[model samples]
Target chain A: MSHLHSLKRHLVARYGAIIAITVLLLEGLCMFAIRSYYVNTIEQVLSNRVQLTADYYQKYVPGVTPLARAQKLLSSVDKDEVALVEVLDLQGQPVLDSDGFIADYRHTTPEVSAALNGQQHAWVGKSPLTGEKILAVAAPLCRDESRDTVGVLRYSVSLEQTFRVIQRLYIYCLLVGLIVIALVLALCYSLACRILLPIEDLTIAAKRLGAGAHDVRVRQRSQDELGQLAATFNYMSSQLDAAERAKNEFLSSISHELRTPLTSIKGWSETLFSGKLVDKPNQTQLGLEIICEETDRMIGLVEDLLDYSRLQVGHITLSLETVEINDLVTEVYQQLTIRLSERHIGLTLDLQQQLPLVEADDDRLKQVLLILLDNALKFTPPDGLISIRTRFEQDIVITVADTGPGIAPEDLPFIKNKFYKGNSKLPGSGLGLSIAQNIVQLHKGRLEIASPATGGTTVDICLPQSTPWTAGTYNWTSKANSTRQNLS
Target chain B: MAKVLVLDDEIRIRGFIVVNLESNGFEVVEAASGEEALRIAHTQPDIQIALLDIMLPGIDGIEVCRELRQSYPAMGIIMLTAKEQEQDKVSGLEAGADDYVVKPFSPNELIARVNALLRRVTLVEQVSSSSEELICDPFVLCVSEYKLYKGEKSIAMTPTELAVMEVLLKRSGKAVSRDELLDAVWGPDYFGDPKIVDVNIRRIRRKIEDDPSRPFYIETVWGHGYRWHGESLA
Candidate 1:
């Protein structure tokens, strides 16, 4: 609103000044033309009168006395015509006046003396008698036989009426110029407002949205480009609103997820340290068991977060190796034997002895295996059936299926998205599936999940047999070194 | 022994609470969800306290607190919540929870807060046998039945609110300091926040006083405590 209002100021300065100056110039030109036209008409009429009177005198009045000729010309002048008639002697003295008075010729104009010297001339100035603006023309009279000038014929007309008309034209031009300036100012102001008002609204809305007032939306006025911009602003604002909501929800869920175990561990440690359970040996043992299990849960959460961070920055790399799938499966099964027996879940593994060695990272493969088995154990109730198998048909395939409650159809599509823990209440950091997909993709493999109609889920990991290909290397954790030692 | 219901989705934390309470001379009952807790509360009418965790799978603890308060106004409720969920704490308190213990709290702080709330919200039949009933204008206190009546109609109040009203009525027309009220309602050795007294008094006034905003029966002495204007009749 101040002078910093650049749009309005720009419009008025760039075009408004131009229009104002053009109008002023046209008005000035019009006034000048009118004044000059009136004055020129007066001069032309006076010159024509003097020339005609001179010719008449050359034929008839040259030989008469100068006084008698001046009298005769004054008397012959028509009363209705505006031009005044005067006759002058050879000495530039007035011999006859149309107003019927003879007075000072000491202030004689050059045109009068030049006419007496046998020439013709005209002058425009104030009349010596009444001080009225006038145009005067003078010419010499001659006889055809002698060829010498005898007297001068002069005609003068007052220009007051012509100047009055020109002054009126100037006033009219001035009024028109003022009106034009006002119109131009109004036009510039409207044009600037039309372009800038919506933009200002968008700016304010965008600022509020940036400040985390995510539900803000700009007002849309027209179907023009600015209106489209406003629509986009509104759309973007809603998207930010949803994202902020999701982020907060995730924070709250993550906060609860992290705090529960911390509470258990902290509570157990405090209980154990108090030695109040010292006499109750079973309670003390139970406290120590909970502390260790909660510590392990914390470790898993940290590992998932760390892996996700590394994966996001494109830093995860696989140390490719020739590996036996059955051996890896057996090792993972051995790792989970205690957990499986605790839940009384039965496992059936069918390993293909002729399976080809696939190029993969052993440590990462172990992590994916652990994630699948852990998910199975968490979801499956006691005495449920769990099965694992490996087969080869152009690619090595491994499937881990659990007799557990299958995922909802709506939730299956987004199950692999990062931090997308859809209304499921299981107790993991929601990054395991996403990380598993990334790991499989790094190995040129595919991960597929399916929920059969018999109320269970099956996950398939298909690893393509690499043709001993090599291209690039990235820095990864040093667990590859330990795996290499074991394989050797 | 005091009987308490421990409701939590996490098995380990629930065990911790149960063990702590059991060793401190309390009988413990456990429920894994809001549905189970409500079921247990319906079956067992004598449970004196319920310790609820705010975050659970089926239904949140605040809803449970509301339902419990609606049905059993005298039951003492305590919320166990994470420290970062500050809004949950306020909502829990507004849902008629007597106190809250932030997660990762020391065993001593947890027990102390729990015991302080238990004292205010529990009826201990150890009053002197001298006065069987106390009477004031339009109000009657039945010490034998542990009830209050306004013009022959009983006013439903939580144990904590009734205890505060009883203290103010006992020392009618005398300014009782906040500390003095705290020691009377809670035990003398109870080291906890005194703000619980104000919350209880407000709840009590809402039930008895016509306008809780401008209280007349119980007057607050500026920079001190409350004074009851009634003359006690026993």
Candidate 2:
């Protein structure tokens, strides 16, 4: 669930950032284009009007003085269309002004000077009289049939109306762009959420599955890649649920089967040991030993099944403490030496001296060692050599090798599966290797089994010199400590 | 020899217990189911104790124990339970069983429990004949009746609790160690934990004392055992 929440947040942030940036860029470009187009159109209109007036003055004004021609043109032009109009002569002195004749007035504007030099020019400046921004254009007046510059004609228009139009255009474009951006953001948000909804569902279902709710499944809502993933998740959970049920059923039945015999055996043994069968000395002696051996076997089987079940359900806890590997090996060897002797098997121990103390669950590690030794005792023939060897490398490695008939290639792989009883003639529950492997794994160690065709089987257990502390390990240790305190 | 009713679904286990009980001088009656056990119990009026297996086909041992307690209030009941079904033992006790023995238990332990219960029965009979009731102020112990009265309210107790209270009331104002109480109640041959006495004492105090922790009648002699305050009511 937390994973799903974080994924939703990440998707929203990434898509939202992209959409916002794209909208901003597009709005900026549109505003610039609109402003430039409006300004350029106004400037072009003013320039064209100035040229047309100059041509009309040159053509229709019939041999009059330059001042008289300028006055006639200015009187004909509309004042609302053009703010200021002036006529200048070749000597850079103002010939006529729309405001009226002024004494010693000179038109020294850059556009007027450029026009007198036979160039058409446009300028934007603040009007000297009105103090408003204005666009001005100046055109050269030429003599008829000579094309020589005679006077300059200038026309200027206030830019306030044009600016107001541009401002309105800017606001309109921004409104449309904002609406489109909001729509796009909403679409993108919904699309992203729709795209991630199935994945989020799968994540939540997977969490439930991991927490042992095996029946949980994701709903496939669409025929997309995410839908396929959801389908796969559902299939996996169903498989897990089936496997769990099968295992539980197997364990329950096996426990019932194992306990029934154990109950009878233990009951009769206690009955006989309670001196009820004391009349026959020899028979009682043999019966007592048989009872003892069978009871031990039953106990071994029960412990193995319990250990496997605990490992399966993740209930196995370890009490970690420093342990000398050599000492531990020697102790296991001593505990099993009697059994090995009873089977008439020769034993050898090759342990390294002064081995370092490895952090592990001492009792669980010993259980692993005993399981290996017991297996070796069972498989090895009389007068066969059984070697218990230890090496101090990067890790502590302990190997129990037996001179027994090697496991068949076909049976080797399934040997560690619980209740996979290979060679039914061999009297054992087949949980030995699996339990040992689980115990070794709990200590952050590894167990390997190798059997050769030449009649030997070797089991190696490698344990790390030190294990890092984890939350799981801490919880197990604390639980173990509390149990110990209760016992004390 | 006391007549003991043994009920178990497993024939072999039932046979084993019957043999063990018979050899130990108890007259044993065997029944395979709750219905059969009830029938035998009703027909045999002399049945003094019952050993019931908790798991049965029709009615479980707990139900049978409850039914038997209603019918025969004086009959001693011991439940036989599997080791894993510990909850059954507590339910058995609540249903009026006096004690429980886990299955696959040693034959000697079973025999010892039966003998101890019958011994307590005989002791109660003897006490009733000697005295109707033993009174130690606000508390009254009717030995023959197997009941304790606090003020005017009578409180029913299990056989184990009754035995322990009887021993303490007999020697009121004197400290009796846990070992002495266990010997008197569970018997000298009882190989169980001595903590059994402490448990029964706590049960008795819960029933008769206003405050079990600061017990008014059953006072704890530190490091020794319990003593009953023997001041009589005016």
Candidate 3:
């Protein structure tokens, strides 16, 4: 039943109904007008015929009997036009009949009686002689020049033929109307199909797209609204496909990256556990060192991945405070000094005498500084120069510059994107730069990288200057310290 | 001592393998890239085996294995692959690697594989020196020359394949159990799966038989092992 209701809602039902109603109303009006004209013309022609018969009887057969005159008049008139003629006396008694017989003597029609009173009259009624419905007209007849009525002359014509023609015409109009409605319905069905087919195709394509069939597209050749809609859908699907590919690539790379450190740790632990190095103290010491270092690398990788996931979910909370920029830089540099020296890279710190304190997370700022320094160390060759400098401008700017092979121009833009590793052969997980950038942004600071054409890279971290401490802020910090102590 | 080439891009891993292999009384040569590995293989004829890492800086391990297999058919090749990459192990084997040791593997497992491969090489060499050649119908095994010939065509075989063929032919018309073949080819000290015997047998059949599926010389003995069907020549 619902299927039928929907079918009726289509163009066939909607447009066809309008066309059918209009045709029906026009057909009815045409039939009514034709019927009125037919009846009126027939009545007028019968009245005139009756008057001519009365005149002829007075002029040509003055001495004849009234019955003979009536008979003569009916015989002379056309049978198709005038079906009956009658002559009645002043008392409304029929004297003559055109059929040469009378069924009743006192059955004079009202028109015939009115004619006997010397008034011409016409009416639409049944003929008494023929018993058929007809239009009859009656007129009075006088003798010589006297106005006294001699008898009444009446004429009537059958209405059956006019009614039959009108009925046949009505049937033709009905048939024509039906054909036109059928044609309109067929056109409407095709028109509805033309509009609905593309929409159906788009629905199927959208389902496939949702199912991860990213290459699915609808064919749209026309420059209409649906075509434009299809074009937009295609563009969106392509974008999703690219994003999915990038995600898969990142997952594979990250897995490989995570596995490398694991391999080292496992290999070294197994080596040391095998009891082969027990007799040699120095080898044992070296083995233990490698095991510890590889373990640290693995832990760092895990922490980096965890931080990236937390940042993705917007779950990172910072303990913000006023941190001296010089202190933060010095702490990170001191931690990385031994590692840099191992690579034969020199670290030079150029700190301004009066560097302003910045409002930021001190731990998170140290993390960013360490990430930048570690990246520079990994890329720089032996005996390379790395400089850490702090200066005060609109913001407290801390720059770490190294004489290393700088990033390629094309890879510079996407370096900060999560899991975007420009070179797969590198040892670190690709989330380092993105994580550092996120932390800096959380502090409302900006981090920028510049790779000079000559050959070196520099990373600049700018933090907003801290507002002067007030008594209220001091109380807030004390309360925060108490909360931290309680949690620990 | 047998010379072995250890190829890995990581200095620490290379150092670990060198220390372990050297402690086991094998001379080790290290190469950081595939190109260096190929150069060393070309120059050092005495190097009997190579432990190649699958992930290298240039010309990855699979390609290196293919190249080295073409140049030195007698040399043993063991691929060092990451445990999670199953496809790498299969591809390495398909590229003519004799065996594979997954990364994060125990040093004992690595040493055992190296010893097993080297033992097979030593056994084949001893067999070749003892007898100049071993013959079966339509095939000739030149033991001392380390070559095999079927009619006029020369067949290439790894050291493990040669050792298995030597054992099977010496005990002709006798079914050799997989364990016995493993003992004769890999030595008594080797602790590994006996399936290694089946893998070598399959490789040997592909090189020697016209139809490896139905071998004329080597035949399976129901539940036992392989039998040398030399009765066809009689």
Q: Put down candidate 3 lDDT per residue, A1-488, tens digits, no spaces.
A: 34433754665777988988998898888788887888888877777787887887667663477667666656676666445777776666667677776535764788877897889998877767678777778899876677788888777668778889878888888899889888888888876665666677677888899887968888885668888888888888888887888788777776766666666667667777777777877877877777787778778988999998876665676777777789888988898889888879999999997887777777888989889988898888899999999998898899999999898999999899887878657778888999999888877789999998898999999877877763126322233444765698
Residue-by-residue lDDT tens digits, candidate 3, B112-179: 88878887777778877787677886778887666788888888777767788888888878888988
Query: Please, what are the lDDT tens digits per residue for candidate 1 over residues A339-455?
Result: 788879987787989788877798899888888877778788899988888999878998999999977788899888777777877788888888988888777789999986678
> Whose lDDT is greatest here?
1
- For each of the candidates, the C-alpha root-mean-square deviation to the true structure, in angstroms, is 6.1, 16.1, 7.1
The fnat scores of all predictions, in order, read 0.68, 0.22, 0.46
Every model's TM-score: 0.78, 0.58, 0.72
lDDT by residue (B1-234, candidate 2, tens digit) is 789999988665675577678767889999999999999999997898999987666888999998987777568888887544446656777677767776667777888898888888667767778867778767788876678888889887666677888788888878899889878787788875465566567767887888878798899998899998884333
Write candidate 2's Cα lDDT for A117-235 as tens digits: 99999887776656887888889987676789988888777888888888898888888878877887688778777878887787778778888897998899888888888888889
> Worst lDDT window (10 residues) for model 1 chain A?
A468-477
DockQ of 3: 0.46
Clashing pairs in 2: none
Off by over 4 Å in 1: A1-20, A44-63, A66-77, A88-92, A95-107, A110-122, A137-153, A182-247, A311-420, A430-488, B83-86, B117-131, B143-146, B188-193, B220-225, B229-234
Model 1 CAPRI rating: medium
Instruction: State the iRMSD of every prediction, in order shown.
Output: 1.4, 6.0, 1.8
Considering only chain A, what is the TM-score of each predicted structure? 0.69, 0.53, 0.66
